[model samples]
Target: MKTFGGPVLFLDRSDINTDEIIPAKYLTEITKEDLKPYILEDLKLSGFDPKDDKTKNARVILSRANFGCGSSREHAPWVFEVNGITAVIAESFARIFRQNMFNCGMAAIELPKADLDLIFSHSGQSDAAISINIEAQTLTMSGGGNQKTFPFELSPFDKALILAGGWVDYADQKY
Candidate 1:
């Protein structure tokens, strides 16, 4: 899997659900581009266009506890993928969302709330950087000397999936 690196955009809170990631109404039959506009619409509560907010450069998303709760819609991860959110760092995650993320080439990192607070509380003005070295099993948040290490439980298949650029591409390669 590609190491998660670059700037840290901290969102400190809890109970961010799948529906909040991608509203249930859009779950019906939407193209990837159509779904992009609704990501974080429910939670960010910002009427701004979701597509405009999240792009390839918005590398890391840091959040609080139970990060992907509520319904297990595949669309949740789909929305993240469409909007170019590569990784999410949270205190904890719903089991399904975690799996879905790995399947879709998105890295979900779990860390203690205290560690989360340190990163989030760093500053609002400067552009801070966060790096995750999978080989080293460490997470370093730059600009504040706050660093922590944690275990990531990824199945071999999931790792391969991520490295291959997601499940569909992985499948196409194998079969």
Candidate 2:
């Protein structure tokens, strides 16, 4: 499987439900482009507008406990991937959400509370920099500290999907 290595951006929060990630109203749609504009809409205190924000490229998302804590919609992770979220770091995650992310070939890691805090602080700055090196299993930050690293459960199948550039691409390759 192909691996990811990059900086991280921390967002500190707990129990981020799937409905907050993507409301029920948008589920009728199939295109991820349609879902992109609404990601974290309910969670954003000021409302989220992707066009006006350049954080779209933030490679890693660090959050508090239970990051995806609601519903079983597959669309949750789909929206994240469509919007260019490479990895997610959190204290914990919902089973379905974690599986969905892995199925889609996105990396999800768990870190201690202290490590989570470092990334969270960066969100306030004009330039927040957090780095992730998957092969080395390390997270670096602007302040020069290391974060807790855990195993990512990438099955051989999941790795194939990521290496082939996502599920659809992998499906096409095998078929």
Candidate 3:
């Protein structure tokens, strides 16, 4: 399975739409690699800069509720995949987008609002990082001078999909 967790990109907002994740205009690009430079190009987060080094280096995304809230295309996850973002942890996700993430061998993790609030509290720390242990269903966030661990649960099928490197590979094995 693909390795997950590392330097995190914190998007402190809710209802981030598909268009903002990857503008619709670039969907025509022939290869996933072509979509790399445009990830979150249209996201209007207050302090976000898509061109910033932090954004480019982020291996996971931490966001608020309703992430991937618009459109049903798979391109959003594809953009993240090509950019080397293997996981997105949010308070909630648009159903289709969540499934798309798993289909692409990427994680779409949901934590309760209380847990998200606790995580976001550390957003100000530039060194913030998250370590996810899929086998244990735990997320550990650490930065500055503090660290905390939280528990999460995934269904058996979801776990299988992630372990098998997404739906395609899971199907290949099962069939």
Of 1 and 3, the candidate ranking higher by lDDT: 3
How many backbone clashes does every candidate have? 0, 4, 0
User: Which has the greatest lDDT?
Assistant: 3
* Worst lDDT 10-window in candidate 3: 153-162
Report the C-alpha lDDT of model 3 over 9-110, residue by residue, as the tens digit. Answer: 999999999999999999899998999999999999888999998898899899999999989979899989888898999999999999988888788999
Error of 2 at 49 (Å): 6.4
Q: When superposed on Cα atoms, how far off is each prediction in RMSD? A: 3.6, 4.1, 1.1
Deviating ranges (above 4 Å) for candidate 3: none
lDDT of 1 by residue, 1-175 (tens): 5557776655566888888788889887557777877777777733223445333356678888898998888788777767667788898989899888887777887887777776777636355777776555567777655554445555677667767878898888788
| lDDT, candidate 3, at 57 | 89
Please, what is the TM-score per model?
0.77, 0.74, 0.96
Model 3 lDDT vs. the true structure? Answer: 0.90
Off by over 4 Å in 2: 1-9, 44-55, 143-175
lDDT (CA) per prediction: 0.72, 0.67, 0.90
Q: Please report the candidate that would top TM-score against the real structure.
A: 3
Displacement of residue 113 (Cα, Å) in model 3 is: 0.9
Model 2, C-alpha of 104: deviation from truth (Å): 0.6
